[model samples]
Target chain A: MGITKTQIFNEEQNDLAQFFKVLGHPARVAILQYVSNQNACICNDLVEEIGLAQATISQHLKELKSIGLLNGEIEGKKMCYCINVERWETIQNQLNNFFNKTKSNCC
Target chain B: MGITKTQIFNEEQNDLAQFFKVLGHPARVAILQYVSNQNACICNDLVEEIGLAQATISQHLKELKSIGLLNGEIEGKKMCYCINVERWETIQNQLNNFFNKTKSNCC
Candidate 1:
């Protein structure tokens, strides 16, 4: 959507849309799933796991980080990444609220 | 993502991503919320409610319908739309499963 279009909707709508937009890509979704499934922070393995180029994976990681869904730290030479649990739960609740409040009115 | 890139991910990942991609816009989210909030199916009120042009709203509606999130019918000269209850529940559960199964592995 255009920048001016976002002003019409409320904050919650824009926020939720941002989250959804970030996760709209399959690579991003795959990256989140792989990172979440790990027992420790992942570094330098996304390219192999997601079968994408390093640059592509980094771009996807950037998108995920932009939405606060990821936490990253430089461990010596590598940047390790993990899920941001608090943000994850908050997003989960927000989505749940959206689903719960919007009753189905099929005609 | 490119058409060829979608083949790299499994069906579930692709399907879920498609759902998120369709919902990435606030206008579509607002449309779903507005239609779901009503007791009856809505027809021709989206323009005033979402503050977008008729063509834009129609395009968004088309995207939502493509993902099976909405059901539309030609009612006289106007098209009425409502949430697809079964598809909605399925998507909600799919999202819940994705959130639940992907445990937080914050570093």
Candidate 2:
């Protein structure tokens, strides 16, 4: 949603929606997967691995970083990126709790 | 993407995108959280719980169910909805794998 429509939602709802919205792109997912598989901080290999332009990958990286899912540190002219383990665990726990609730009294 | 732009993306990417896209809405998130917090299948209480109209809640429910995240069972004039545990686990695993990759050589 744009700015106005989002005002109707509570803070938590908006935060959760913003998190999911950032994941709505496949390129982002692929980028996250690529980073996750590496098992170490990465620097500038997305263009070759993802078959996307440097600018596109950079944009996706920016989005992930904005959400605190991917952490980055500047080294020379390049930026090194890795998953934020604590944030990842928090997200995992939040989502797991949501899914773990079983149906006790369905319709 | 509407129709044509989606073609540029692979099948797995598109499927994952679809799943995240369905979750991009705050109303949907609220509904999911509500359902999860209930710990049971719920039918027709969304209007009261979510403060939305019946049509709006129904539309959101349909979107969630369409993505296979929520399962519904018919009972009389109502529909009882609960989380699809198997699919939820699959989604969790897929996302976990994506996040588990450590950055090997980021830019």
- For candidate 2, the lDDT comes to 0.73
Query: lDDT tens string, model 1, B4-101?
Result: 39989999899888888888889888988999888768566889988889998888899999988888998888778988888899999999899888
- Alpha-carbon RMSD, each predicted model: 1.8, 3.5
lDDT of 1 at A28: 84
TM-score of every model versus the real structure:
0.94, 0.76
Clashing pairs in 1: none
| Cα lDDT of model 2 by residue, B22-101, tens digit | 88888888777777667556456888877777877888899998988888888777778887767777876765555444
Residue B39 lDDT (model 2): 50
Q: Which stretches of candidate 1 lie over 4 Å from their true place?
A: A1-4, B1-4
Q: What digit string (tens of lDDT, one per residue) describes model 2 on residues A9-71?
A: 798778767777888888887777777767456557888877777987888899999988888
Model 1 global lDDT (CA atoms, 0 to 1):
0.85
**Fraction of true contacts reproduced, model 1?**
0.74
